[model samples]
Target: MNDAIHSSKAPEPVGLYPHARRVGNLLFLSGVGPRQRGSRDIPGVTLNAQGEIVDYDIATQCRSVFDNVRNILEECGSSWERLVDVTVFLTNMKADFKTYNAIYADYFRDNQPARTTVEVLSLPTPIAIELKCIATID
Candidate 1:
């Protein structure tokens, strides 16, 4: 049976969807961003009055997004080491890829999951990075 998963410790999803869903032994996580839990602030991001991104630190955002993904996994009876696949979205690939890649290597040094990084025009929020993950769950 499949079950929807929610995490009080993770940031609330910006849309109408659960944080993750478990089917059998696999957990599917929705797109996770760098926003803080219970707050609209995106780490390392500065938004002007127009709600447009003024400046952002890719290193900070990468770490935050990884932590956010880890929180969702652990909250749903999974873990970072259990992750089997990861899909990364970046709004600025040329500008941020190097920094993001370095931080990602630091986080996934022990458990290197299959990853696909893509450049997107934007995201649902004013954040630069997002992650979608899949993990094995007991």
Candidate 2:
């Protein structure tokens, strides 16, 4: 059976969904963005009052997204080292991949979870990066 999980320490989801779900020994996380909890502010992103992203810094967005993912992982009694797989979304592959990869390496340096990075037209939020992952709780 699977059960949903939420974290007070992480950014609330933009849609109707929990931050993570547990089934057996694995926890699956929803797409975690760079938005801050309560404030809903997206780091590394400069948005117009209309909520359109005018500019962004990939490294900053990547770090914030990772922190959100970490919060969900820790809440599930897991950690970075426990991550088994991850799917990353980026708005600008040509411009952002280099910085994003370098910052990502700093987080999963030793753990080395299987990862796939894809260029998406856009994310649900104005942020430039997001990550959804699965980790073994065992």
Candidate 3:
């Protein structure tokens, strides 16, 4: 059986989908972004009048994305240590990868889950980064 999960403390998803879904012991998270809970504000990001990204601090976005992922995992009965895999999406890998990787090391030092980071032209929102994750819940 599959169970859809929502997190009140985490940012609402940009689209019409649950934050995560549980199939038996495995939990699959939707692509999680750095938007803060209850608002569209993205940390370290500046949007122009047209809502296009003006500038962004990848390090800040990386931390916020990590925190958002963790909140969803904890809300859905999993945790950072329980994560089995992560897929990262960045709008600018060349400019952000080194900073993102350094911060990622800080967060995943003890529990390093399998990870893949990629560059994308854009995301649904003006945010610079997002994360998709899989974890086991006991």
Tell me, what's the RMSD of every candidate? 0.6, 0.9, 0.7
Better candidate number, 2 or 3, judged by lDDT: 3
Off by over 4 Å in 3: none
As a TM-score, model 3 comes out at 0.98
Give the range of the ten consecutive residues with the poorest summed lDDT in model 1: 6-15
lDDT of 3 at 40: 70
Tens-place lDDT per residue, model 3, 18-95, is 999999999999999998997877999999999988889998989999999999999898999999999999999999
Residue pairs with colliding backbones in model 1 are none
Q: Tens digit of lDDT per residue, candidate 2, span 48-105? A: 8898988888888888889889888998899988999999998889999999989988
- Please give the range of 10 consecutive residues that has the lowest summed lDDT in model 3: 6-15
Please write out the lDDT profile of model 1 over residues 19-114, one tens digit for every residue. 999999999999999998989888999999999999999899998889989999988889999999999999999999999998999999999999
Give the TM-score of each candidate: 0.98, 0.97, 0.98
lDDT of 3 at 46: 94
Full-model lDDT, candidate 3: 0.92
